[model samples]
Target: MVNETMVTFQGWIGTDVTDRYVGEAVVASFRVASTPRKYNKLANGWVDGETNWYTVNAWRSLGRNCMEALKKGDAVVVHGRLSTQVYEDEEKRRFQTMVVEATSVGHDLNKGTSFFTKTTVGAGGEADDGALREFNAELGIGGPQISSDGQALGDFVTDEPSKEPAA
Candidate 1:
């Protein structure tokens, strides 16, 4: 990693995040579009420059978090290792694409405010419901309701009846 290129990009999500299992490890892939703007003294206005696109890949827990938290059009900052991928088409034309293997990805707080939720993982790499329950209790909120089959029914206790249709 000493000589490898590392870059930080601030851009808008250009495509939906897609996550899939690669041999038991999850990987999320998405595209980001970055456009540079500059102020022109003569024009007395801001000038938009050409847009550059890059593909980003995040692995493991980061991948899962990205799949849940990111959406198209959201402003985000991505920091990662940069590399180039080359391919040849059927017509014998060669193309190169920039790719970022993301180490950190987060929303641009300057753009808007966001809520933070801490996730607790158990020893087995599963969510720890006890931690969530304790947090909810501390906040004076009810914890999630779990079904007999181990599925979460609701996030908080509600006085109103269920709106979902009975299965």
Candidate 2:
């Protein structure tokens, strides 16, 4: 990919994620919209600029995770290879779009908080409960009680309750 264009985008998910299988490989596609803002000294406020939209495609495990974790309106950051795709309609009109073949995609931490869960894939390329248990043991915590679908059934333990000033 020496000649490929690489870019990182920060934006809000503009559409619902579409997950589909092309043969044995899964791909998840979605639209992201990024709008720029600039401070206007004369206007004494910030001005909104035109939004740029990009189509993002995540492949394989990333695609599956995206399908489960992402939704419209969520703020996210995507890093990937960028390219333009052109298509001709039946009427011979041409349409062009910017696409990102995402290498990594995640929620924007500045917008909100997120919980992290490590997914361990076994030899057969499936979630491994045993591996999760081992990981939990290494962390000196009780083994995570996982459901058949791989979701943690045990409640998360927090160090302390949030101490905020009384309103």
Best by lDDT: 2
- Give a tens-digit lDDT track for model 1, residues 1-167: 58999999899999999988889788999999988899999999999899989999999878978988999999999999999999999999999999999999999998887676555556675546685566446644344654434566677866867666899
Runs of candidate 2 with Cα error greater than 4 angstroms are 131-167
> For this target, which candidate reaches the highest TM-score against the unseen true structure?
2
Error of 1 at 95 (Å): 1.0
| Candidate 1: Cα lDDT at 49 | 92
How far out, in Å, is residue 163 in model 2? 40
lDDT of 2 by residue, 1-167 (tens): 68999999899999999988888788999999998889999999999899999999999888988988899999999999999999999999999999999999999999998776656556776555686666556644433455545667784465755444779
In Å, residue 12's CA in model 1 sits off its true spot by 0.6
lDDT of 1 at 16: 93
Work out candidate 1's RMSD over C-alphas.
10.0
**TM-score, each model?**
0.75, 0.76
RMSD values for the candidates in order, in angstroms, are: 10.0, 9.9
